[model samples]
Target: KDSAEVTIKLKNNRRETVASITETIAPKDVLISKKGSHPTPYDVIHKAADTSNCINIAFLAEGYTETEMEKYINDVKTATDAIFAHEPFLEYKDRFNVIAVKSVSEESGTSVPSKGIWKNTALGSNFDTFHSERYLTTLNLKKVHDWLAGTPYEHIIILVNTDVYGGGGILNYYNLSSTGHKSFKPVIVHEFGHSFAGLADEYAYDWEEIPMYPLDVEPWEANITTLADFKGKWESLIKKGTPIPTPETKDEKKAKNKVGYFEGAGYRTKGVYRGVQDCRMRTNACKEFCIVCKNALTKLIKFYTGE
Candidate 1:
């Protein structure tokens, strides 16, 4: 009936900080059969296995200056609407609820403080101006937990308005936004791909930070793995000639005809895995999710909706 708190130690210093975030069951009164419902915070219900409900998405605008508040809200709402309007999720439109929160724009992360608090960088550019550390630190997990647990939603989606290129994620922690003049719509979808569906980034690149999952083992997720034990997950979707390393191409024909391992995926160089080498989850191109990500999301949708 309430939310839970999580404490994490910083990878750099092993300093412990508590994160406050909430995770509660979706309230019974919030379900609607029609569109334009403006679902309330209390309307977000948590049914991990209920096919009638999807994850509750919450948007947080940490504004140090009042100047950007209104614009922030509108931009984020538009971005979110556009995102869910795509694929498998659009079919279950009524099942998800979205909410927005306004919080103090606290300064976070000494290394990249401008983006406030975040764990990693995605579209690295503006190092400071729009920075809001919505991700890196765990000092507010307790409050976040309380807010989510007290609400009707099971998961919380956070969109930070700082123009920095930082964002973070966990089993249910909020997703950070990239700050700048350009449209961040694609990044919003990309971050959600990580936060909501447990989807891993398929692009390979160097990063100062390491990933949470090991590449050598069969991943616990239903999609994206090193195929160490391919049969454990995603193997059924593999078609013959679909190599272990998938190539990055815009070939729609290839997307339809094969399921192969693409190179430069899973955020690391060594692991051979499956996924469209180019997807929103893998790049800033705002492309559709790979079939692998879709299948995983479909399972999550079914889990929440109880369908």
Candidate 2:
């Protein structure tokens, strides 16, 4: 992976700054240096009469070529349908504008460093981010924004053309996934949970005990918790007598369906906790968002749509 040396700086409102050279390295920024896609033909897949009141979502192509642009549009339709079939988004379908932007790529697939596979994709997306083989992501945020500069978009969803199971998202950033994967629908929705509603991953891995959430400090995400500020989270929704650090039970009606402070989240086996025994944020097996996630999602939707 041929990466370049780059520097970044942060500043306060008064313009006072702390200067430091952070070694931000990655695969060469191919997408940014590439020529722009002008006369960018697009279709408003879902249109609302009141643009000001509705959320704008654009589906852009990542690893598609000019010949595959039509197919990309169809893929966009599939993604739109997938998200709309679920809760919250389903209930408030009309309050959104879905646009399909045809940004053709020089090559037709993403890079997988572990597999020694690389291609000149539109967004420069690839697998093996942070040495996590399936963790697909693109650091070309500026290029992404540049591509959608003229489009009416408040949210972004970049569909990569691949069958490998990979996708990633960040809050208020973008949702990305592989359209060719079997878990396409669920993966996109799960990543959307991160990008749109600021939801955290409920799943945990004992192998990697990264202190992403300090036990003394509460997480700002709506789903997971550190218990330092438990009252600020979904405390109102928890029924009285429900045990804290809720134990996972064999009873489907009690454990899986109920909202309790289940330990193990944010990639840690301990110190972190999620609001439910199981949820879509936790696993693809649980198709629906848990009560807490749904509530947080609904609040965000209402705030945007004024519903």
Candidate 3:
């Protein structure tokens, strides 16, 4: 079937068919079996206050050989520490469970096509995705899902054992990050913002003219806005005295930190605006999520844990 059709059965035994969703299957999208594969064991890195009532995140090891399992565990620790050290997560540390799955690979580093280097990583991740050198990602969704078949996980984080600086995340899908980069800690948290809370990238790129958000329609994300439907966004969080389109001036530095809409976000220099002038989603230096992102994350956590 070109699309997957799902049916919902009501309590009264009534059946309702929902719209079909298309599935894009690539030639590389082959399924791998864990049976007799001697799948590596997993460890509970962070024990939630109540595993039955809290969010569970699983960090899967990629591109790390069996001998380098120690390094993989340490890398997971660094990523976990960085996550809980920030707000929203810090306040709700007890409401999360982190696990590290030691999925040992035959090789120790990911493929860098730009440098003509390739390794037999557990997950076949590589750089130069879509011709973008920094875009690191993997097409092995089946392998990722197969590894977490019986785990109590709602999120997946693949830690690639490479020092090259690159990572990518798709909301509620997966997070792929390098383990040994200088910016690894911050980058993981930033990518987590994308995967965990559906937070949009707050950074703007002047060279590209990518229009991910239409000016007339509101973005589904909680952070960036187009003023088309600001009412549903963080408009109420804006300070009383703050300007609508917060200026990029030194004079408004204090106000910039406030919950005012700052122009330049979502890779666009105009129309789109983010909740704060600086945030973890915007730059690597900012280690904290903006108030708007924190609020959204809190709501998402509550939804997941029924708290």
Candidate 4:
């Protein structure tokens, strides 16, 4: 069935009906599982009642062989624990349902183009994305959706089986990361900040001499800003009397926790400004999302959960 009648309702905390509307919605087309099809197995890592009111996240295996499916589920649990370890997610844990999709690969590891290694993975995910050695991603999005057909998933998290340190995320699309990397926890959460809340990278490569944002126009991301429209971003969140271009703290720890308009984000050092000296979006150094990012994520969660 490609089209169906869906009723979207808004309810109050008291369970009172606030508003309701029904509309015709068409879902994306994909091959449904049949008796002859080798349907992939899935586990409900976290389940919620009335899934219509909850956010569903799918953790799909990218390079795990059939024998490694157990390890894949373990990875999903680890990643889930990492997510709820932070603020907002921990506070709103009941608003989510997590699933682990075990899509076996003929081989056990993803491709590393820089290393001239390729595997016949389920999704054909690989490193060296866009010439960046650490940017792991997949171009075969169709296969990903096909594998996830009939799953109650709104967000996609592809767990690639490799110890390589790399991952990437696109806004509202999906987040992919290496499950075996030491930085897996932080990398997945950082990528989630992108795919879940449309957050931008709060880091830059000044040495590259290429700007990702225009100084004359503000970037639409909730965290970083071009100062062209500072008020449209976290400008109001900056403490009174704080410097516009916030100065770095002498101590790295203090800097990571501080919230201010720190210039250096979106792959450019000068023009773009971020909400903190350092953030989960910036590096794996910080253990959690910065205040500005937390606020944005909180807002998004509330929107999703109708809170």
The order of the candidates by lDDT, greatest first, is 4, 2, 3, 1
| Better model by lDDT: candidate 1 vs candidate 2 | 2
| Candidate 1 lDDT score at position 276 | 56
**Of models 1 and 3, which has the larger lDDT?**
3
What tens digits encode model 4's per-residue C-alpha lDDT throughout 27-73?
55355333315445789998876677999999999999999998999
Q: What's every prediction's RMSD, in angstroms?
A: 9.2, 6.8, 6.7, 7.9
TM-scores of all predicted structures: 0.67, 0.86, 0.87, 0.85
Taken over the whole model, the C-alpha lDDT of each candidate is: 0.55, 0.85, 0.85, 0.86
Off by more than 4 A, model 3? 1-40, 249-256
Instruction: State which candidate has the highest TM-score.
Output: 3
Provide backbone clash counts, one per model: 57, 0, 0, 0
TM-score of predicted structure 1: 0.67
Better of 2 and 3 by TM-score: 3
Q: Model 2, which residues run further than 4 Å from truth?
A: 1-39
Roughly what TM-score does model 2 have, to 2 decimal places? 0.86
Clashing pairs in 3: none
